[model samples]
Target: MGITQVQRLSAGALKPLAALVDDLGLAAHFQGDAMLNGIDPVIRSPHRLGEASGTAQLLIGIAGAAVWHARTGKKTDIAIDIIDALHYLHPTHFVQQQGQPILVDAEHVEVNDIFLCRDNRHVMLEAGPPYMKLLKGYLNFFDCGNSKKSFAREVAKWDSEKLETAMATAGLPACRAFSREEWLAHPQGAALGQVPVIEIEKIADGKPVPFQTPALSPLQGVRVLDFTHVLAGPRSTRTLAEYGADVLHISSPAYPDTFAQHIGVDVGKRCAYLDLRNADDLVTMKRLAARADVFTNTYRPGVNARFGLLPAQLAAASERGIVCMTANAYGHSGPWAERPGFDQNGQVASGFAWKEGEPHKPRFSPVFYLGDLMTGYFAAAGMMAALLRRSTEGGSYHVTLSLTRSAMWVQELGFLETTRQASLPERDSYPARMTSIDSVYGKVSFLAPPLTFSNLALPNASRLSPYGADVPEWPA
Candidate 1:
């Protein structure tokens, strides 16, 4: 999509809020102008950079507040700051420890960057255990070692497309960067653009169960079962936790996440472990789902189906009905639906990386997983809307979102071009944007929630449990 095409997308991005309200039959209750405040020309591009993201955040907040009103007959003003929204998009960058900024290891970055191949094309390789294993395999395929230099040298020996094909065959997460024209013409990209940014489907029928209004917050008594890992899905559950939902995050020992990645997003939730492969543990998960009001996951399209934990299955297991929200890297459609992906892969496959840097050298967007963050915010909004629908209409809902679709929305929103230099906030300014909280590890500083309401405050408690620290059962 070009600048002109993206400009047209900006208007389309804002239509979701109205469509959501209409879809849920809540047009009568929702009132207010859906506008974002305090956005300027800081990060320049062809699209409405700040407005697009800020508006999505604002809409989610409003939707949450609207759900509150639906259950309690109380209305609240919703607002979001563009700067804060942008900051929330890259929370890792703004996180601090004691008084210093926490730095990601250089080796981590070196291994995860876009590399030039023999054909003069660029491919991104996200570095980690499985990725590193795949990188080693690719190197071995080319008769190379496991060092960064060796990986780069071997990558340069193969054509970009050839390497991408080999990595895909090995079920690895790697992709060759595509230009805007190339991406739009690609089948995956075309399918992605057609997918809704958020799709809420009524999967099962049930009686309307009105949520009890709480003295503290709208979601105070709600139970959210989080089966997400990494950034996007975790961030969505964290948003619910901030609003007073009892969020229990489930993971397995087989899949481990670094403290650096989990610490920022794990705040305000309980953590537990359940090995689904074990029949006993699978029974425990189903019991938890039976009592859960909402369930969220980031497992690729069919992985959950193998275990019979798909959204429809979860809804059937739960008596009170449930809201199931899921996200993935590519999308839930197209040839790449089953393909494993991440923020970097989405950036490369969706053409965002190509536009971020110069014509010759495409750099991953410096904004840091904006695609994942926005998807989280969008998921939160969609989940809230689904909740409201269940309260009124009575049915199980499945809400779907993806990193690639969010990239498309960002592309449609386009970018803002300014000669002004955009720099990070000063250390002194960090105090206002960040809050200190006690965790199992120790004191951690992280960014505050981006949205605000006139009636309720987001919980300030930031205690985080160690991975699998709690029992699998939900609170009695």
Candidate 2:
């Protein structure tokens, strides 16, 4: 059934608050089956109307306050509480002020003004008018039923005329929007095309190669110099590594170790560090790239390129030929390129935030980094293909993966045939499935009969042997 006009109007009202919604990461909680089952009426009802206004503003405000306090380093309990809630938002087109608390407001409704005390021991909330006070509470603004209804009523009054007025007077932020047709018409549709031939091979000890097409293995023999920090870039290279490429990860002295701790996919790699700001460090990195078949990095755009890491600039460093893979939350072309971003911004820009379920519920797993990881995969794939072509035909290659494009690419599975004028089958004889493997301490084993099928499956966590000192050996 078609959505009612009221639903559309509600969606329009909720548009301005989309950033906040993405920030909180609440899509799965607000939609379809979830709308019927999720909790909290205030955040849930407007979600029923297909909009998430009050909930969004509430989250954005809370996130702002929590992020603000993270800088103070003392009395951070309050900040920590909200900080976890706020992490769901990423790829934001903004950077927080280094030493200040974030203040979030919407149409004069101040949702939060929280402080992370300098001592890093506690958290405090500045008071707000009662109507706007819910922002300081649980990151879920929809928890306050009265405030949610009130916010919904306020949003219902916003329409195209009101938006046009805001744009005309407030100087709305310039953002990119692609029509369904425009996106389909993009020249790189060839990249999205799916070739029909398939081959599944057990390549790695515990990994299965699924759905091999002529278009794949394009990244074979390419060695990538990975200078990415955090989940996005590292995860990208992991995908490349999956495609049978050697990836050397270079960290910086200033880099954080949290990524390696929390992410498991990066288990099979080596690491090194270079302080790129130093002359010697820069020289070393350049030399490494000279031997690298590809270079991948994800620091805001132009920051590294100026130091000779960008595609055009890296041409001078190639010894074995290089394919540079660059990833950014926003594409290099936008006003927001230099602005800080994470998955949150991508979710917002790509319409994932809007369709997300039950407005008040915070989004889940903004951690996916589907774009960055896939971009890494595509980058590796592209570089491999480019390298093969170079060997036979010859030339340098550059590949770009944008958070925005990657976000849109997620929908390609459903959109390709219609949008790209490509042929795709409705079903497959060999469907893509996740196989599970187990490990007992350091030894890995699979749950199968003596005679098992060939295919590498993703490893899963299993109970370790608690044999206390001397452990018995398993028979081969």
Candidate 3:
């Protein structure tokens, strides 16, 4: 059964959550079931995107707060606001500055929507600033009139499958739209099926270090080295930061993200710079890794592995057991495992786009960036669960998830067809869900943490800062 707006998570409700916990090998770590704090219908979406992500929030909130529970014999029984529970998934869409909603330069035909190809099929294309340099040469070939329609016209001359293959082989993000059945039959889909929805595995042996005295939040005193960009990866570390982990987000000054994106994702953490290519900078990061409790990377799986920052590498660099998380697009075991991708690519490749718009127009889910954002919630839960496991078992653990994998899991949860066509709320309609902070970046307000702890707090402990604004070193 597909989940919709659930006001309260009854005993029999949220069966999909349990199935996912078993799939991720985290059932043993869960102290008990979680619940929702408020009524739903807060988020607008056809699939159970809101409910699935909301429940994911509930899972991680309790997992992090459980650290406090372990010390004081408190049950960290938390209730996620059925409405605000989904706000964090699409932070930019709801962020406010001086009482007005912030705007993201998110639209461009070159990287924006579906294009019809020669074979009468469709392909999703993405060429964001970070990867545009690599795609420039290839995209310029289709530079007809230098207009979006001209670009679409040129795309129509190429077969969908060939165009997708060429783009992916060049390390660019592109995927042909496929129906649910067609996706299930593709090699990439078959490969993804072999991978778990989420993977949390121990990779090294070490001594257990119990949780210290509970203080500000559940993850007080814990240090997280965040080497992630954009959504999924950053959101995971952001959640940890809110729960009292000293999260230091590392980004290179060489390649910068739009200031809007930085504002959306940098909340609850200190933004710093470190060039991994520089030997001295690498040493600094290694030293920090050796002392960190959790490390998160959102780069394509092997990109950081080349720099000796992979799970096993980080585990070896550390003195004690640590939690390492890797979030990506396709998945680790697939033929397209290393393929670079974005949220819409996941939707296109995994049949969501087709499901939403078929025989007419290929469309993305109504919710803001469903695939990538939902994966963030999965990453956060996996990290907290792995950390909880490491504190008791004493082994470096690795947590892994992908946008495509999250899309597939949501399919398994079932969609609420009856509510699929419901009228939705517009932007800034609910100010109560928004939280403001006098951040280092400035006075800013955005979506709060989706879940609330009965025993802990919300709004996190830190302020948003511009990228590379802080020194590389962790807080002393």
> Can you give the TM-score per candidate against the true fold?
0.89, 0.45, 0.91
Candidate 1 residue 172 Cα shift, in angstroms, is 0.8
Model 2 Cα lDDT, one tens digit per residue, 145-180? 334444343323434234223322432211222232
Indicate the worst ten consecutive residues by lDDT in candidate 3: 1-10
| Native-structure RMSD, model 2 | 19.7
Count clashing pairs, candidate 3. 0
The lDDT per prediction is 0.74, 0.37, 0.74
Query: Is 2 or 3 the stronger prediction by lDDT?
Result: 3
Among all candidates shown, the one with the greatest TM-score: 3
lDDT tens readout by residue for model 3, 1-476? 22233444346566766666666555554465577654334445445655677778776765665666664556545666555655555667877677777755454434467889999899887765335564574466565554567768878999998898887767667899987778878998988777777788889999987878756567888899999986788877877887778889998889766677777777888889998899999999999999999999988766686788888888987988789998888887758888988888888888877776755687876654777678887887788777777778888999988898888877766654435445555332445465688865467887655665566664346577788888988777
Order of candidates by lDDT, top first? 1, 3, 2
Give candidate 3's error at residue 182 in angstroms. 1.6
Q: What lDDT does model 3 reach?
A: 0.74
